[model samples]
Target: MPMIRLPSVLLLLTLGCAPAASPPTAASPPTAAPVQAPSAAADGLDAEQQAWVDSTLASLTLRQKAGQVVFGWTGGEYVAADSPEMDRLLEMVERDGIGGLVISMGLPHSYAAKLNALQRRAPVPLLVTTDMENGPGMRLAGGYALPSLLPLGGGTSFPPVMALGAIGSDSLAYQVGRVIGREARAVGVHLTFGPVLDVNSNPLNPIINVRSFGENAGEVARLASAMSRGIRSAGLLSAGKHFPGHGDTEADTHIGFAAIRADRARLDSVELVPFRAAVRAGMDGMMVAHISMTGLEGPEAAPASLSPAITRDLLRRDLGFGGLVFTDAMNMGAVIRRYGQREPLLLAMEAGADVLLQPIDPREAVDAVVAAVQAGRVTPERLDGSVRRILAAKARAGLHRRRTTELDSVEAVVGARPHGELAQAVAERSITLVRDEAGQVPLAPGRRVLSITYAQPSDIMAGRAFDRELAAGGWTVASARVDDRTPADEYARLRALADSADVVVASAYVMPREHSGTVGARGGFPALVQSLATAGRPVVAVSFGSPYLVEAFPAVPAYLLAWGGAEVSQRAAARALAGEAAIGGRLPVSLPPRHPLGTGLTRPVRTAPGHP
Candidate 1:
């Protein structure tokens, strides 16, 4: 099988030698032995690569240089060669001379074909990127076949990063990254915005909940650094995100301004720990958040993406991160609502972001930067510095050598069996039994189970996998689905239905939504759970999205934390419920009051026949 060969710097990164931000805890995995030749150069490139970057910077005109920092977006859907969409994209490349393209979602083969088409027309090779925080399947839709197993489809979508934190294995974290990287690169994605470095210190954080590795700073650092190495090893650039941290904040940046209110000393100890480790690990890039840094500046300061104090002084100077720095999507409400259109673009450049990601208007963004440079608001030197880094990243991704992806090999590489198996394993390992006061878990195989799923009306995929897995495990499952829109009168009837079952299993799918700032068990779902708890049947409450959902129905006798709403997590939760898989995950974050960090109950897998 052919593979994308990485450079020497990437090979060193694969050896897993990033220094520890702090000493390892008993629960934390030991850090790898430090390698001496860290790839801490302005760009982790060879002499030949550096020459290409230098020459590319020298050749570009001011407009092109300004456009080089402006990254545009596109859905991975098929675009005809001569269509208006393709024409607009080509103009964005030729006229605007945009440096990168962010692929949001699409089918596997079509996604690669679109990129190949664009790459062929691009004046300079475009740095194709995506938010494959979990895996490419998170965006791209479609399935692929594997021998004897259900056809593993789309890209291999793993459980969220919190799953890794629960499993607490750096090696597993690396494997997850490697799988995500390979599948992303297979689809022509050069960079993955991943290994969410946010520490997830605040459980109520609506945006960054399960996306974070865990709350502990040192553990988060160790696991994230390991994963970043795996990403680089697969020849895809990895970008640690929401720096210095978005986990400690309450507001969702996708909606409005969110602030990290930590002091500098606390920031160093918690929020910045993983980022520092990312820097030492030679991570290819860092994505600044649309978050305010109250620690560095006063009560009222611009977001870190536009704050020179946070981006240039803190991340670049103090942490010494020389790689590409990307602003969180410029179209996000935090940026658009605060600074409107043009000002944020100019401010982000002044703040030293190499790439203004997914701007609302690419032409306007380029024009704004060009005008700023002309008026001396943004210096030519500053513009050139960013352009140089952008070019260096493209070179590092081997785009300078081969711009187009092999469309024929897309399916063979993406959604392959190994990737799917790894994702399932991560999910299985991450099913943490936080509480089992009633000892109702692993409900004997023949028991009558009333499996009710609570999700938003839009989450149609929530409980299908869970209920199917439970039924396949030899249990008789009477399933009911409740969304926020489910009428209040329906719950009394649902409670009556729950009373007849030997065991009632409630699954909560409260995940983060982009524009919606709040997250929890919505509407009458919590009341339904409370009624279920009081019912004679032993109720097992499993959270497949936010671990903090337990706060809503604290009195449920049995509780399991399966992390996210991904199908893998639902299936794992079902397996854990049926004793098919062992429950080994520990809490990466505290459940608060009753459950502190690291609280979990272990259970051995049932080896008896007929259990499957």
Candidate 2:
């Protein structure tokens, strides 16, 4: 845990009020009429826009200025604009003057309509943001459900950035970014909290598993930089998120504080690599994680979101990032558990955050910041600096001229046929053959296949698409689902089905999800698969989620990494299993000493004679 050291120039730039080294030279004679000094707003903004920003800032009360830094969430599902939720949100926009909205859950058209209505009521246009990590479909159901990042890299599967790292193609990463931006902007999303810069160095990390690009610093940096550029190219802002890096932590910050134990030197070399690359790539914004750096922040292990040393000094000054700085979410357990609700919001702004995202109580948080300002604990100049950055970002997004989305064009742009085709192609290419020790894959065309889908008991239909794809391939496929609560008798029935089948294809849907806290299979599912493999049934394990499943159940004779749980990923995996397509994906992250990084076994496309 070493301290971060900033370069002299960056330190001076970030100090905000460093004295000039020398007065204007005699060579540049001062005009007697008036020495009109350069205005602070003129640094990044044009005169007209800066004047407007200054006027707007002048017009706002301390409370309103505080509210401008607070961002609230909207699901965009309400059909009635007069609903209680809508009314509450309108109050936040019109009365509280909340500056931004993050689209948490919603339908495309309804979300657009709601945003338009909110915009009409607000004094200033809201800077709208969304997760949109995988694509607009990640949050907006009707939008193009781009394949999760791991599966998107190859051709169209929206191979996860990990796969893109494995493929080592910056161009492919750029394309993925472009698609993300295009679809996101179509739905009125201004910024995407994406291109997760965390280098998944720790295999046990629960939150950032496959969501991150990969373990190698240089590779992650290369791909993330390309993706950020693609997002910018699409006229939408891109955020390189969970910054400082959440890759090495084992805990999920959503539930509690996640600690990164790396020393400053280690962080500089590994964790901070992609972030530095992101800054160089001109990433528009960065979302600070609620992670603690033990070495940097001391034993209290303060979350980076509330740490000026981490956010302002390390990220802003040392790293030289001049764009917007965002907190991951003030509502997250890591923030609330330590600082309570209101204090974290004020602390985040003091730590150099321009946008206070997803506070537990938006109004209360704004009130606390305003009170802090009134009490002289927080300075108005500090508040104005963040407000200026937020406003500048909005202007950059063209929100000043047009804040609402075109509802009629959303459907045409989202989930467009060509994008679907591209997705399918990428998924097909990303189908990786991890192991084929027994040569069990490409099951003989007419063979009897038993497909077992393993998921939580709540997700009964999780593998329906995988089953459908196998059926469509003309295999005599029988599907069985096993969860944690399945009885011993159910296992007996499943074993009988596996015994009858010529080949057993098991789809392990142990994806990294919110609150799940683990990526490994649950409910003795892996044990059952192990039993089938022990019984001499040719078991081919296909992972629709974590690629590291092989490390958990190494006894499985054959293995495949589908990289995602998307329908396209399932179908592509099914096609690969049925010998209808090629299996060419390589492992993006290492499975430690057993299977190092870059470890996929390649196989040529196999189709029955005259089938192609």
Q: Which candidate wins on TM-score?
A: 1
Q: For residues 25-48, what per-residue lDDT tens digits would candidate 1 score against the true structure?
A: 111111211111224443668887
Q: Model 2, residue 449: displacement in angstroms?
A: 0.6
Cα lDDT tens digits, model 2, 71-106, are 987774534877898888998899889999887655
- lDDT by candidate, in order shown: 0.80, 0.74
Q: Candidate 2, after superposition: displacement of residue 600 in Å? A: 1.2
Please list all clashing residue pairs in model 1, or write none if there are none.
Answer: 142-154, 143-153, 544-564
Best by lDDT: 1
Error of 2 at 179 (Å): 1.7
Give the range where candidate 1 is weakest over 10 consecutive residues by summed lDDT: 10-19
Model 1: residue 571 alpha-carbon error in angstroms = 1.8
Stretches of candidate 2 off by over 4 Å are: 1-51, 142-159, 607-612
Q: Which stretches of candidate 1 lie over 4 Å from their true place?
A: 1-42, 142-152, 609-612
